[model samples]
Target: MEQTKEISALLQLIDDPDEEVFGAVSEKIVEYGKPIIPNLEDLWENTPNETIQSRIELIIHKLQFTDLAEDFRQWNVAGHFDLMVGSLLVAKFQYPDLSTAPVLHEIEKLRRNVWLELNNYLTPLEQIRIITGIIYGYYGLKGTEVSYTNINDFLLNKVLETKRGNQLSNGILYLIICDLLDIPVKAISIPKQFVLAFQKPGYSTEEADFASKIEFYIEPASGQVFSHKDIESYFKRISVPALPSYFKPLSNKKIIQYLLEELANCFDNDKEHYKKEELLKLANMLD
Candidate 1:
């Protein structure tokens, strides 16, 4: 009761003309964290002063960013290298209120649909075809080639909702569903593009010969399977010499870092300097 009363008193001073007093009050309110958000929101709704409303909004954003930073730190320490969780955390930077349950449910539905059609008798290519049919044909998810630079293309939740995304977002979704279905699809970070590789059966990532174990590459945007020759040709076309690291499957942590780098690029294009810096900091945490 006393804490609530104190919060109420602090809320009253949010409109104080003195800048130092308002800053002190804002600091105290922020210490209350996420639980104080609803109260701040209520105050914003009721207050007639635009300045106070802006201050309240800033306080809310600060608290949310604090929570996001802690979540990212914990995710890095846990060391499970969960791709879905990392992608969701990246999404949370843009959408602080985002929930992972619905996103997981959507991915699970795709996994279940693909799982029903898969069997030991089917070849790896056939399995990929089935998944492609379910995701691209039946579900109507497509590549956002025209709006590729849009920041929304990088957010998993928005991609799931819109059924359109750039290479990385769609590729991540494809990888997560394949993972859930126990398929051997892995993300391969090539120059200027994100693609997937089908690992040969019994090829373990722990093995030193992991790079040689990739059977073929799959382009998630178009469900097209291509060979090493095709990758070579692509490198030639782009005028960049191919490196061994480009063919290697990226760990989930590295995949998240790549996604963050892409997101920072998006923010930079939009001229959102602070957001770009924040994303870069989060990306470095994976290191």
Candidate 2:
């Protein structure tokens, strides 16, 4: 009852004309996080004052963003980094109300389709064919070639919804499905591109010798599989040195960092400095 009285008192002070007083009240309200959102919404609905409504909206955004930041920090410290969760965190920046159920359902549907066709005797190339057939042929997911610079192409939820994304988002989705199905595919940070590698049997990603066991690479943008020699040729054509780390699989944290960097670049290109800075801050957290 005392807590209820305190909340009532705070809601009454929200309409104070003084900016400093309103700021202090807003700070106190936001400290309660999402539990206080319904109360704020109720106050906004009951009040006709535009000033109070605007203050309520700002406080709601602050509380929600604070909740998301805490979630990201918790995910980071939670033992193994989850790529799907990390990708969804980036998605939450645009969609604060984004739910994981739809995303997981979509991924699971794709995994089941691929799983039915996979067998223990299948070669690595055959496994790639099955995954590609389901992802690109059946599902018809294609790369967003025309609007490659669009920010939506970098978000996993958006990619799943639209069935079209840039290389990075598509690659992350591909990696997630493969990981779920116990496939040996992993993300490799090739220069100017993001792709997945099919690791040879007996090689674990955690093992130090995993780099030498990469069988081949697959471009998720179009589900095109290629050999290591092709990567070397492409590197030569681009004038980029053939660095060993380029072929190695990236950790979930590194993959999320790369996705953030791409998001920052998209914002930078559009001259949205605030969004760019925010994405860069998230990227730094992964580091």
Candidate 3:
């Protein structure tokens, strides 16, 4: 096939990922090697559609990546976090087809709250302290044993004890804040680590976050990494113990379902079930 023809076909497969396309492109990139990268660059320059151009750049970057790959070992609970995230996204969020904007708005609100509480002067320990406090305040449910203590120990426990998939530690906070704040952040799924990038809200143009171009990273579920105390408090309302295995990002779309199911789960008693559903529905409308 001609080079331009191959590039056009490759562009079509960028956002798409099926066996035939992914395998063909992956094999071809490996075959053509780095020399074909300039063609990708040239195509990007000529592409008028900004989204397509950016996607082209990402394809180039991925093709060029020579990072180490993981063994996909399941020795511990660390790597299974994505499973929790996927499950929550599927089962908890009511599988909503909602816009990503509101979630981003929530992130902004959360960030401003954190900025108010800790300002920019917080040490790592202090930041953890404040985070734990907020998690407890917002998410603490009943009958749970998770604590808001040992904030730092739990945060770094995985990396400290296990592998160093990614070097940056505070990245979780950055992406969460960006999502909450309504920034144009997108996730890049990479082997062993998920990463994030940011852009302006309007599509077809770009204003990359923190002045960094082509931000890369791991995907974070909205509410994961809630400090121990926060996790405790979050589940405390429901009377369940901490199940790190179960926590994932919460969504407005699913919050109602969670609130309802939780009511059912907690109120086995007849009197509370009927009364709670009526009142909860009323309040949800307000929210």
Candidate 4:
């Protein structure tokens, strides 16, 4: 970061034509971590060759990604996994310089708006309707079907900024709000679908009857509500047996891992396949 003699030498050799030498230099530069980013940026600006600039950019990305991977490791080992923080870390994968304050502010605004409309006596259905109304109707957040071509749909910050996201990202946003409000809504593993369920008060999936514990199912994409019968029909359509494990609420860590796995699908091209590997590595870290 301070541009010591070693750092300077490494920066100079960043243009080395030998693949082995460049790779070695890149590894050492990445070891300096995020603090060394500004130096790399300055180097990129002054360098005339586009090839050298691309090399510098790759080094800078490695530095940021190295830092982000550690953050993911810490999040995995923490006593509690926070949904909002986990989602933000995934966003940082694509946007290293993302400002979290504005995202937090937007979330706070939505939370406060929904909170104001809530009361102690409201039924679970009423409370969910209020959240759905405020989020989809008042805030006008739009949910699109998941598409790997649109990477923005998988990011939390982008979702809040653009008011659009795919099913998984939208479901995560819904989970974060429900968590803050102390509601029992959770994302359940519904097989190729991102679905939320409203667990009845004092009901646990550990109970013998899995379906009975859920008051209703929610479609995160459009804030659409469904009954047990609807979910049954879905299982029948897919020809998959409805198992209790599918009804269990996903942990925050698992949800973020799923997000990363889904996000990796967006980078299947020749130039960006490394990103897919990196994202899958991050997803495996959560395991």
**Estimated TM-score per prediction?**
0.89, 0.84, 0.22, 0.98
How does each model score on lDDT? 0.85, 0.85, 0.39, 0.94
All candidates: CA RMSD in angstroms? 2.6, 3.3, 21.2, 1.0
Estimate, for each residue in 189-256, the C-alpha lDDT of model 3 and write its tens digit.
Answer: 22222334433234332232322332222223222332334434545766765442232233322332
What TM-score does structure 2 among the candidates reach? 0.84
Best by TM-score: 4
State, as a TM-score between 0 and 1, how close model 3 is to the true structure. 0.22
Worst 10 residues of 4 by lDDT: 203-212
Evaluate model 4: give its TM-score. 0.98
TM-score-best of 2 and 3: 2
Greater-lDDT candidate between 3 and 4 = 4
Ordered from best to worst lDDT, the candidate numbers read 4, 1, 2, 3
Between candidates 1 and 3, the one scoring higher on lDDT is: 1
Model 1 stretches astray by more than 4 angstroms: 1-9, 12-25, 146-149, 204-211, 269-272
* Model 2 C-alpha lDDT per residue in residues 12-64, reported as the tens digit of each score: 99999999999999999988879889888888999998978988987887788
| lDDT, candidate 4, 200-239, per-residue tens | 8888656767677899999999999999999999999999
Give the Å shift of residue 183 in candidate 1.
1.2
Per-residue alpha-carbon lDDT of model 1 for 1-287, expressed as tens digits?
23477898998998889999998998998888898898888888998888888889878877887898899899999989888999999999889999789998998888888888899999888999999999998888988662426888888999899998878888999999988888999987788788899999787666765558888888887777898899889999999977767767889999899888778877665545767888898888888
Angstrom error at residue 27, model 1: 3.3
